[model samples]
Target: MSEYHIPVLLQPSVEALVTDPNGTYADFTFGGGGHSRAIIEKLDKGRLFAFDQDQDAAEQAAKINFEGFTFIKSNFRFAKRYLKVYGVTALDGILADLGVSSHQFDEAERGFSIRFDAPLDMRMDREQPVSAADIIANYDATALHKMLGRYGEVTNAKTLAEGIVSARARKPIQTIADLLAVLEKFAPRFREYKYYAQVFQALRIEVNDEMGALRDMLHQAAELLKPGGRLVVLSYHSLEDRLVKNFINKGKFEGEVEKDIYGNDIKPFKALNRQVIEPSEEEIKMNNRARSAKMRVAVKI
Candidate 1:
């Protein structure tokens, strides 16, 4: 499990999540099953439903021999519909660790890591038709600029986008090396790697439609969770953390909370903590990936 992906904030997340040992639960990002295994240990008569779009994760799920576990090989955006198929309308808790798994980043052929000069394919579900290369090749400069700036938070995104358009016209940007050739010219000196990371992040998010999927899952999770049920999320970046924070605090992704006739704020969930939780210093020392993790816990209202 450690080789596949070290589960960040494992103990803290599970502790906050499993309020009832005999209640139903869901692990929306069952990357390496580390969290799922811990969750299973906390269960007595309870059942756990795990979801992952990655085939490798599904393979890992197959190794779990627990009778109480069910692995759903689908994007968690469809959690509501899929859970209904198993006759589960309400949940005691839902745990989502939104970081890309270490396994995915380590796999050179997966095209997630900038260290590799592999094909530009960043699909979390390999079955997905569109790849990062396609986006670079097909998207206009405006579309590219929007994706890089909004998703990656890349500075000088417009310049980079225009550069990519000009470069791809001579030859297709089909691999990491090809993209880097164009990106290098726009990247700031001494910060080339950071620039590459930002561009790759943009491509991966677009390829996966991660933000859209997260929004769908969060809305469904609110509906699926019973009153007082927990919604625990570990987000790796600001884009995800902001959405999670807004949904829990304001009941919507953007704008102020809604009000009823009496002017009381109407929201689906209430935050459990005044501030986001971070992994222990020891955890970050052992796994650098834990450094960026921001965890938030909320209860259905």
Candidate 2:
């Protein structure tokens, strides 16, 4: 399990959510099944359901033969409907480790790491039609600027977007190296790696529609959870953390919490922690990816 991908905040996340050994649970992102395995161990007569859209993750899921374990090969955006088909109308706890798995970033052909010069294919699910390369090649300057500015939060995003548009006109931006070649000049001299990561993150997010799927999953998770059920999410970036925080506190990604006619809040979930949780220095030292993770938990009201 450790060789596949280290689960961030494994103990804290699992312990925080799995309050009942005999209670039903769902792991919305199975990844390498580290958290799923931990969840299943704590369950006695409880049933566990997991979702993973990536084929590699599906293959990993097949290897887990734990009792009361079921794997769903679909995006968690469809979690509610899919679990309903399996007669799981309500769940006692739901967990989502939203970080890209080590396997995905480590695989050179996936184009997730800045160190790798592979095809610009950053789709979490290979079946997805739009790859990062497609976004780079097809997005107009305005669309590209929006993606980089909003999703990546890159400095000088507008300039980079215009540069990409000009560069792609001479030749198609089809690979990681090709895109980098055009944007390298715009990168901050001392922070080139960070700039590349931001660009890649934006492209990956757009290619997979990560934010859209996350919003859908959160809505479904709220509906799927029983009253007082736990909802745990570990997000790697601020964009995702913001959404999770908003949804947990306000019941929607944006705007203020709605009020009922009786003058009480109508939010579906209440946040468990006043502030986000971070991994310990020891944990982050061991798994560098854990450094950026922010975990938030909520209880359904």
Global lDDT of each model? 0.96, 0.93
Following a full C-alpha superposition, what root-mean-square deviation does model 1 have from the true structure?
0.6
Give all TM-scores, in the order shown: 0.99, 0.98
lDDT of model 1 at position 246: 97
lDDT of candidate 2 over 191-259, digit per residue (tens): 988999999898888988899999999999888999999999999999999999999988888999999
Model 1 scores a C-alpha lDDT of 0.96
Q: Positional deviation of 220 in candidate 2, in angstroms?
A: 0.6
For model 2, state the Cα shift of residue 92 in Å: 0.5
Q: Which residue pairs in candidate 2 have backbone atoms (N, alpha carbon, C) closer than 3 angstroms, thus clashing?
A: none
For candidate 1, write residues 1-301 as lDDT tens digits: 9999999999999999999999999999999999999999999999999999999999999999988899999999999999999999999999999999999999999999988899999999999899999999999999999999999999999999999999999998999999999998999999999889889999999999999999999999999999999999999889999999999999999999999999999999999989999999999999999999999999999
Error of 1 at 43 (Å): 0.4
